[model samples]
Target: MDASIFSAPKIDCHCHIFDPESFPYAPGVFYAPSGGEIATADYFMQVMSAYGVSHALLVGPNSGYGTDNRCMLDAIRRGGHRFKGIAVVENDASASQLQDLQAQGVVGIAFNMALLGLAHYANADALWERIAALDMCVQVQVQDDQMAELAPRLLGCGAQIVVDHHGRPDISRGLASPGFDALLRMADSGRCAVKLSGYDKFSREALPFADAQPFTDVLLSAFGPANCLWGSDWPNIRATRRLDYGTLLGVFERSVPSEADRRTILVDTPMRLFGFGTGGN
Candidate 1:
């Protein structure tokens, strides 16, 4: 692929940083990388530079670090303009702690329903107010089957909703799938936005992930360009097979196909949702 194709400034709205030695992983964490190929802030920066990604939203990786966001916080502070963060906090997190996180460039909180259940967000009302006061969004990771029950609750929380992993749809059922349909309905409500990410998680196919394009098309149509964001899901830790950063970028280009739409998904939408810049791409 031509490097020029990625010339427009891009923001990776979802990625992670893990430094277990400094910020040790929680005991009995659900998942942890077996090999030593951990992703760090400096490594992520190198990847971003190679891909023309000017900014990134470093989400707290639930699998490795659990709710300890110290590693992510340090990265955001060190990265300056190059990185922002989405932290994971306990339900009883105090106001001052949230303020401190906001001052450090954390624009949202992450709720990984796959690991933590709905009970984890039992204090949604309070969390909503705290995050809303900071003008932050909420990042949600839920399986396709959980959408119907979870979407309504998240929408009612009164904070901007960012659904992760193309809403983690069931590709076998396509658009007719109940969870995917609920995702579309949530997007239609105008309060929710979906991240065009984690193709490796949702697609049953191999590289190029052509099978996932229809889901992307429907999400773009339902949410429109402004409410949609694109992410590399870098390092692609969950991938069953080897994947390349450049190849994934090409997949996005081929899937979206229009320069205008590409600009929107790759640049404009994330900038607007994550508060990256003053103007559109």
Candidate 2:
């Protein structure tokens, strides 16, 4: 039996990179970019090669770069076939600008509503329409407090929605919590997908990542294998050193504990979500 044939095709659905030494941070933003001087796309490729990840989604980081996607675009271009990107756009970006981004292999747009607040994009309907016509997805990072207030409107905007950071659910509130339940409802409608990343963000513990499993269980059950995707959340920000991409991957192995489940989470699903396949390439 060939090991390559049996080996899982990993697709990382979330990650961020920036060259702090070259790119100046956008001023006046509360959310700072992840530390590490210039962790380039080449670095990520080496890590992926070590882990058997063949493809990845390069999520543009919110390091106060504003709408200047130059660094991210360069990273994706250099990453070649191994990477795709999701970008940040001004609420009023013109259709031509969006079309240009799509041409550059950007498949989605991410909004950090938790930190930026919903009111900023009050006039984003036109941009949303353009995205819908282009068939792009929208990645939203909203914690539980804002999920009730913002998720429905975001979902109603007529584009595929990717919920970030384990749907930003409150673990202490349990599985049936409104935020997690809302995510389930979105998955039920078949228009939403969730990233099984960022265990350190929600859990209070130092290790094992057991505290984050309930949220993962709900996502797995609600979205089934197809609508779920996994991310390394490399160089984890808030909890920083407690977990690296490798540590997260290990926790996933222990928690999921099934090759079939892992395959869907790691491979099949992300390809489908990111439009990487149609008749096996």
Q: What TM-score would every model get versus the actual structure?
A: 0.92, 0.90
Instruction: Report lDDT per candidate.
Output: 0.81, 0.76
* Residues 153-271 of candidate 1: C-alpha lDDT, one tens digit per residue: 77777788889989888888779777788889987677688888888887998878889989989988899888888888876776687777788777878877777877887778877
Runs with alpha carbons beyond 4 Å of true place in candidate 2: 1-7, 29-37, 277-281
Q: Tell me each candidate's RMSD, in Å, in order.
A: 2.5, 2.9
For residue 21, give model 2's deviation from the true position in Å.
3.3
Consecutive 10-residue window with the lowest summed lDDT within model 1: 1-10
Model 1 quality (TM-score): 0.92
